[model samples]
Target chain A: MFYGYFNGTIAPTDQLAVGITDLGLLRGYGLFDYFLTYNGRPFQWDWYWARFQNSASRMHLKLPLGKDETYAIVMKLVERSNEAISKTGKATPTDVGIRFVLTGGYSADSISVEKPNLLILAEMIHPVPAIQYEQGIKVILDEYVREMAEVKSTDYKRVILMAEAIRAARASDILYQKGGEISELSRSNFFIVKGEKISTPDRHILHGITRKTVMQLAQSDFQVEERPVLLSELYDADEAFTTSSTKKILPITQIGELTIGDGHVGPKSKFLLERFDELVKTW
Target chain B: MFYGYFNGTIAPTDQLAVGITDLGLLRGYGLFDYFLTYNGRPFQWDWYWARFQNSASRMHLKLPLGKDETYAIVMKLVERSNEAISKTGKATPTDVGIRFVLTGGYSADSISVEKPNLLILAEMIHPVPAIQYEQGIKVILDEYVREMAEVKSTDYKRVILMAEAIRAARASDILYQKGGEISELSRSNFFIVKGEKISTPDRHILHGITRKTVMQLAQSDFQVEERPVLLSELYDADEAFTTSSTKKILPITQIGELTIGDGHVGPKSKFLLERFDELVKTW
Candidate 1:
């Protein structure tokens, strides 16, 4: 039984609805942030919350609940969902994914809304297969640049429209470039490793929480550069990987027609993935 | 009483709701086109339908209904709404506004939806006050450029976020500029009149239907140039105006601190407005 924290109470997912006049639906005025929960506890909740607040502030959306209040609501919803599964004689999954969405509420003008609607969804977590990590994934180069690149607004039309192009390239994902500089993937941050050094574009990309954790882990033992990365640099790099909440640190072997450094999962990615797992277990 | 043609049925506005899981609500994946109905009839229905189809095509969104089929749905809904108002012992408004929306339907991934949802809304037309047309309205300059400028996607966060700045400047709307070149207003297309020549940015702007009609009417007696117009040109132009479905041909008296030619509605704008009225009456 999936549970959702809608507005102020828990409800079935199917019963959740937004008015047609809500600015979020009428004008696409909304923001969303999501993170994972491991072993019945939210992983890096503070980091995700900070980023959520930043996104909302940038979009001029106001969150109705405070940090602690919202945290309590999410935990309550998750607990209730797990208990419901147990009552049905089913084993509740220890890991789950939670999404926090803030939308511009009902408005007659369809341009701006004074109040905001907060929606929280708790669902079973779907993990990427271990084989994909063992064998690096392929990515294709795309020339699309997202608008308001820093904010995590609920506007992913460019990525949805590029689904066919990505699939035709026989790649798992896309790495976006604009003005000759590589920005990031459609859903993850892109990084290149070159002989003891790792670098990724610092600007015009979503500041992923997992990316931040990987950067911190990498900086402790390896040289890390946060700056503009050009397309030419990726082709010549020793290894490349992407970071996201779902994909912690997945290695990228092929980009377009070029293969990166022997086309195998690099030792650096393996080490970082192991370190990330250890950190998650601690959490 | 307002009525909405939702999917294949007409319903009350209060009952019109979209599921929270709809990709249109979750990811802001939707497009909307609206025009006014005059004398209980949709004005230029064919022209509006063509633009709607074009917008959906650009976004790779498939319309669930054919153009003629959708036209019938809108007319039926309008007729029913008028009948309801007449039964209430009130004067039925001859003019109303209709909005046709296409959403990417429900999707578990929230990125793509196979089936699209078509929603048509018919409501009382809110006409721009005659004072605004006679005395002209003020506008402010905005530096943000829309992504996928050709497709009329439901992403208006930039304008909503800039609402305060526009209000502070005592402007009715904003004229967006990219790289020192004026693109268009938030909801209308910007135009400038220089002596006998009138020009507007040909690219990176929504091709408004009213703008098309106005251009056709103006071409009969005046020079029309569809090219890039810079900010400097707007400041020095002899006349300026904006055109949209709701606001037909509104003169701009002031942009920022600079007052447009004589700080009143210019002669060209007055002439165009009269011609537009004549054309609408003919329709």
Candidate 2:
């Protein structure tokens, strides 16, 4: 369909983002969010906006509009995207994902200005490759600590750089560890399933949308304690997986040189993934 | 006259700065710099570009061209800018200041792209209002901290946000004190002139082009210590000033309720500003 939302309207998926002249791009002064819509209706879109608002507030950024105004803009764009998809026959089941990105607009070369540009964009749900889920993925631990691991700003150069360096050494993902405790993955929330209980690093992750959904879904199946999981915990865990918007609930069969359990998808990860699939449809 | 150096052959100012794009605007994943051109040539552009490259490398970002190629682009842009200003009456008298900005070029929705959109814009010197020199400015401290204050990324969301929020608070500038350490002003480096010694928290501020220049220029006359400046020392100074490309050496007359050095320009700040003017012209 029409990939996602932009501004206060929906256009083609290909036309979702903004121009390069925008200050957000010019200065890296923008904030964004990645979340999914449920059956054409954005699941927790309001919550996404809330987090976006919080991000802007944290950065002391002004999101062109208030909460209600921002919500209206998102809804309008989402509906427009749905229509575009229907017209183009790209609507696959009408269920999709959304990304809400906001920028500080443009600069007139002036230091102080009353108005700043506001940009928003959304996109569709692209399933992660089937290979990653089946065989699981390998991750490496980043020895050095990171800054701004809490906020979701566009300045992800270090995150990408570290991940690429890790990949060059033959790893799929890079996990940030502080002292001896693990924080989160570059883009996903990490979880360790030990015995029958499940635990994960708290907001060390992006407080991921999928991570939150998984936490809610697995409340009954396992105990979900929000805390930092050390690399030692990973070595002893029965299974490990990551929760992200796109990956949903993904298994981590191997980390560094060590294999988890039998070195394949563990029981807990599979059960959690099964439950995640069911939750997304309802969510 | 057009602000930046841009003409037929060379891009003029080289700071790995490139054109604006969706990727750069939305993500702030780029490198940038502003350096003064001595006469028609760059003074310390090379020094600034070194940090730009370091920032790019730190991010594991692959620039569009090698170091030499990028420098050529800047030289080209500067030539163009000079030609534009040559048409103006003050062309000979006017000096040049250039901004080098580069963006992560466009990609197909995915973030992993190898290429980047390069844009270089050069402009004449844009100094603060003349009145600011005679009468120092006021500043407010930011409660929260800015991480990686060293990276010269286009991410000014926090700086902008805090400035906007405190507009009504009679605060002219803002700087966050991280864990009780006075980190830096929003867009400039923080310094306090205590007697004959000029002290500032080393490395907590932008390794600013002007800041570095001022340090080198004043090293013979002033004892420059690059140690941490505590918040408690903010009021104890005879003078306080910040260094940046735009506001080379600006003295702060007041911080909150305290008026620094009899509420006027201190002797040390006055000398530095005077010396800074000569440094830029001769460099």
Say which candidate scores most in DockQ.
1
lDDT for model 1 comes to 0.87
Which CAPRI tier for candidate 2? acceptable
> How would you encode candidate 1's per-residue C-alpha lDDT over B1-283 as one tens digit per residue?
8889777778977788887778777888899999998766788788888889998988788888897788788888888888888899999887779987788888876666688888899877777899999899999988878887778889888889889898898899999998899989998998999898889889889888889989999998789999988998966798899999889999998999989888989999999999999888867
Residue A219 Cα positional deviation in candidate 1, in Å, after optimal superposition: 3.3
Q: Which candidate achieves the best TM-score against the true structure?
A: 1
On the 0 to 100 scale, the lDDT of residue A264 in model 1 is 95
Q: Which candidate ranks first by lDDT, i.e. highest? A: 1
lDDT of 1 by residue, A1-283 (tens): 7789878978977788877888888888888988988777888899999999999888877888899998898888788888888899998776678988898888877786789988999876667778889999998888878888788888888788888888888888888998889999988899899999999899989988999999998888899999999988876798899999889999999999989999999999899999999999878
Q: What are the Cα lDDT values of the candidates?
A: 0.87, 0.70
